[model samples]
Target: MVTAAADPTPQTADAQPWGRVDDDGTVSVREGDDWRVVGQFPDGPPEEALAYYERKYSDLASEVTLLEVRHRRGGASAADLRSAAKAVSAKINGASAVGDLASLDARVAALTETLSAETETEAAAAREAVDEAVKVRTELVEKAEALAARDPRTVQWKQASAELSTLFNEWQSQQQNGPRLPKSTAQQLWKRFRDARATVDKHRREFYAELDEAHKEVRDRKTRLVEKAEALAPKGEEGIAAYRELLDQWKTAGRAGKKADDALWARFKAAGDALYGARSERETADAEASREKIAAKRELLEEAKAVPDERDLAKARALLTGIQRRWDEVGRIFPREAERGLDDDLRKIEQSLRTREDADWKRNDPEQKARANDMTRQLTEAIEKLEDELAAAEKSGDKASIAKASEALEARRGWLRALGG
Candidate 1:
């Protein structure tokens, strides 16, 4: 509030220097250096007229003060405050108000300048936000396009689908929370993201559809295989061979899905287990029947090791021959792997005997002995001739011929030594 005394010696804004009440009841507001008649107030006294216009000045001052406070507090936008300030300034200019109108205009102009800089700062921040938003959206678009470009045949559809969904969710979140992007950039990115998402979805659907068809084919084949195996159940133990053939076919059959394959395999395996169970019962009987033979063969095998230990080749052969005769008498055993194992053990003993016989034959055979004796005779004759030549060279004092003859004679002696002659 402002008050003025009728004295005109000195004034301030509070002293109401800008307002005066005329003796004729006219109210006036001051511009910089001059005063303008605002209105006539004949119904009031000088003080009342001045007070009336001063109240108007107070309202305008409050508006300016409010603008200043709002600018400091920073909830309202700077541009909005600047607009309000312009309106306030218009009201204060040439207003029928009087307490320091010039000062209010100065405050409004100063506030407008501050607001202009604040508005620029806000615009720069918005641009930065928009740029950041574009960068984020571009990354999302690139990632989606990368996913879309994968080979559908090789893609792990479940994981890829989940990843695509997550990327889409991220895109939506950014769209909702991030700053607005340029229309062109936003539309382009969305088109790329949408196209890529649609492509991934299309590929996923087609890939799964093909996989389901393939699974159906495999399922039908495996179902028929199960039926075939089940049909073999009536053959009991005799059906094992046929069941083995069906197993081979089953291995060639492509996979159905895990759940379906597991269910189908249970049926197939149950059928196989039935056939094998019958086989197991027959094997148990055979094993019982062959227990005696297995024991007998085992005993013979323990004794057969002596065949290799025998120093006399003839005795070793005789012992192995007797063991083989006893082995034949014991006859076949059960569970072919066990029979094969036993046969292999015994065959190893036989092979040992054969190897010993071969070595002994090479040592004492008449033909080989005769050939060795012939080679010895040839070497002896050659050695004797070389000795005579060496003696002649040495006696004649021919150093070159002596060395040649001595070297040949020494080589022949070494051959004789190697032959143990």
Candidate 2:
């Protein structure tokens, strides 16, 4: 038969209550009106352990389960709860359980390891993205630099440069946050930059090629003009015509190199000057022949002036008429003192004949003397008008008016001299 155990002291309402304990050895003690769990523990339980705690104390299984769910959702996992429970139990026991502590420590360590791995994976992905962005940015920058070096004035270059600059800036910002690029991206960027550079170079080469061709055309035209000018240097009148043609060609020809232009001009000028000098010498010889003719005309003038004043007026008149005819036959005199000398001598002879005619008219009848007086009055009026005209002409320095007034005065003097006779 079984022996009955001694009865324990009965618990009263005033006595300190036994606190609830979870399956994982987490205890919940009553503090005033509320229940406070001593430590957190895993939610899954040994069913008997949980039932014992519910029976010993007021039922709190539902509240404990709710707390466990809240903790789990808030990043505190079953392993965290278990680790906390072991720490609390060790403290309460006042005896170090190295093995229990080690098991709890191992669970925490494994969780930490998993978190670190996940962080490393995310970091690596971020680094890769950054690297790709950096590669793109570097390519954009190089392309922009090359385009800028080309003609900045062109619309294409300017637009391309601006776009590249903006893209590069964005790419650099991305690179700062991301990882380095692989070899493929780097090569692609370099190729784009090189293509831009090559395009610019091609444009420059074409520009220079056109310029060189234009210069060559100018040089050819100038060379041909120089040869033509040299060829016509020997011909006198013909050379002048050729020289004009050369000048026209020179104007039509586009500009040559500086040295070539100067050399060609000098050669052409020298050839033309030689031809002109020869023509000038021939002109001088013709001028000498003209001078001789003027001298002969002047001698004729002096001979006519030396005609004697005789009673035989008819003979003298006939001689003067013959001299006048001879004067007409002579050619143009030299434009010098010889021409003036001829004019003076001829004027003297004409004045003497006019005086003789006036004397003859005065010696005639009373009707003739009346006519002479009337003519003299008219002459005096004409002289007075001429004097006024001469004064105006002198004031104005009008050579043509002065000459015309002088001729009128001389004609009036002839009329006045007839009156004296």
How do the residues 1-421 of candidate 1 rate in per-residue lDDT, one tens digit apiece?
A: 2224542223564554667777778787767678788887887677888877778888888899899998898899887898898999899888987677777888899999999999999889989999999999999999999999999999998899899999999999998999988899999999999999999999999998999999999999999999999999999989989999999999999999999999999999999999999989999999999988889999999999999899998888888899889999988899788899999999998888888888788878999888878888999999999989988998999999999998988988888887668
Clashes of each: 0, 5
lDDT, residue 405, candidate 2: 88
Write out the backbone clash pairs for model 1: none
The model with the greatest TM-score is 1
**Model 2: per-residue lDDT, tens digit, 89-109?**
344332221112222334445
lDDT of 2: 0.61
Q: Could you tell me the lDDT of residue 376 within candidate 1?
A: 88
Give the RMSD in angstroms, all C-alphas superposed, for model 1.
5.4
Flag regions of model 1 displaced more than 4 Å.
1-30, 34-77, 94-98, 117-160, 163-167, 178-214, 280-291, 308-312, 334-345, 388-411, 418-420
Give the lDDT of residue 60 in candidate 2. Answer: 27
